[model samples]
Target: MSAEASVAAANFVTAARSFVGVPWRHLGRARTGLDCIGLVLLAAREAGVDLPDPAPYAREPQGTRLLEGILGHARRVAEAAPGDVLLFRLGLYGGHVGIASVHPAWGVPACLHAYAPRRQVVEQPMDDELRAALLGVFRLPALET
Candidate 1:
């Protein structure tokens, strides 16, 4: 990563980690609650990147170009550092997003996401199985330093 991208990543990680325990709310974007996409938007905004608002969506929005929409504004990366956005292929669907971060307890790489099943944001260990589900890794436009 370039120096600017590194700064953006650091800034994003700082902002994203703060939302760790927020309850999951469908279509939510506030600190009180958020969904997977909401978490990404909030962190990007906090890091000084204004991403386009995702169209109103349901839990399983099908046949949408959601992946293309995000990739349009982000830089695809070969490796995910703290703060990189992770796109996951959940079975047949492919719109799940998560923020990469260091696991607070394990001190290893993990992903922070507003998991609906958990009803809250949680960090999951990024192991081989998780990597197998990864569709792509991306970083937002670099933030001003």
Candidate 2:
């Protein structure tokens, strides 16, 4: 990454980490509560990227066309960097989303997401199994600036 990109990534990580304890709330956006996509939305806004709200979506992945909606707002990238949106195929359809963040303990890239099962936002390593399930890595257009 270029020096500017590196700095942007650092800024994104800082902003995203501040949301660690937010409880998961479907279709919500705010520090009080957030969903996986809400986490991404917050992080991107913090990074100075304004993205349009995706159209109304469902709780399930089967027909929401989540990935397709994201593609309209961001460009898919070959590799993930801090602040990139990571889309995961948790099932047959486009399933989950998260914000990429660097893991402090391992000094490697991890993902920050609002996990519904856990009922709160958490960060976890993007291990092999997780990587294989990734549908795409997308970067906001403003990140190029």
Candidate 3:
């Protein structure tokens, strides 16, 4: 990564970690509550990366629509680095999103996201299940060389 990209990644990771423990709220974008998209939006904003807020979306949005929205703003990447956005195929819907990060305890790749089932923001190891579901990895324009 370029020096600027490295700094942006570090800042993005830090911003994402700050959202841990925040409650989950569909289409939420505030500290009190946030959804996966909201978490990404807020973190990118805090990292000085400009990302459009594609809000007013359905809780279970179509995969194509979600992918199109992301593709319009970010570029697809072969591998996910800290601060990259991960798009996951959650069963039939496939609209989940998260910020890639390093697991603090395991020192392995993990993801920070606003999980609806867990009802809060969490950092979980990127295990096999998540890897299998991964549809794409994306890097914001600001993080590009």
Candidate 4:
């Protein structure tokens, strides 16, 4: 990554990390309070990336495709690149999504994620469990300035 790229990533990380330690609140949008989905959306927006919103979430996640917007809006592909969107497959319904923050970590790479309950952004290592649960990864379409 170039200096500009590094700076951009740093900015995103800094902004997202600010939400760490916030209390978990469902559908919450405050900077000091956010849910997993809310955190993901906030981080993406801060990174100057756009994501789907206004799509309905089910009363309970189904067997697959837990989020509707992710299913229709975020394009899914196999290619790996910086700033890609990641979707983790925890189970038939349990899933998570985050932005690809770093790669080539000797083992599992790292990504920035906003986890529920924590209500904050965290830099979680993409370990074997994450790798196995990784259901989808999508490029965010490069940005130039």
On TM-score, the candidate that comes out on top is: 3
lDDT of 1 by residue, 47-95 (tens): 7877876758767867436655655767878888888889987667777
- TM for candidate 1 is 0.87
Winner on TM-score between 2 and 3 is 3
The residue-by-residue lDDT of candidate 3 on 1-145, one tens digit each, is: 8998989898999999999999999999999999998999899889887677777788887655755655577888899999899988866866889999999899999999999989999999999988998988988888876
Ranking by lDDT: 3, 1, 2, 4
TM-score of each: 0.87, 0.87, 0.93, 0.68
Model 4, residue pairs in steric clash: none
List model 4 lDDT by residue over 81-124, tens digit each: 44556777645654566666553344345766667635466667
3 versus 4: better TM-score goes to: 3
What would the per-residue lDDT of candidate 2 be over residues 1-145, giving only the tens digit for each residue? 6778777767777777888889999887999898887777777678776666664677786744665655566788999988788888766766788888789898888998898888988888989977888888888666655
RMSD of 4: 4.1
RMSD of each: 2.2, 1.9, 1.3, 4.1
- C-alpha local distance difference test of each model: 0.81, 0.79, 0.88, 0.60
Q: If candidate 2 were superposed on the true structure by all CA atoms, what would the RMSD be?
A: 1.9
Residue 100, model 3: lDDT of: 94
Quick one: best lDDT, which candidate? 3
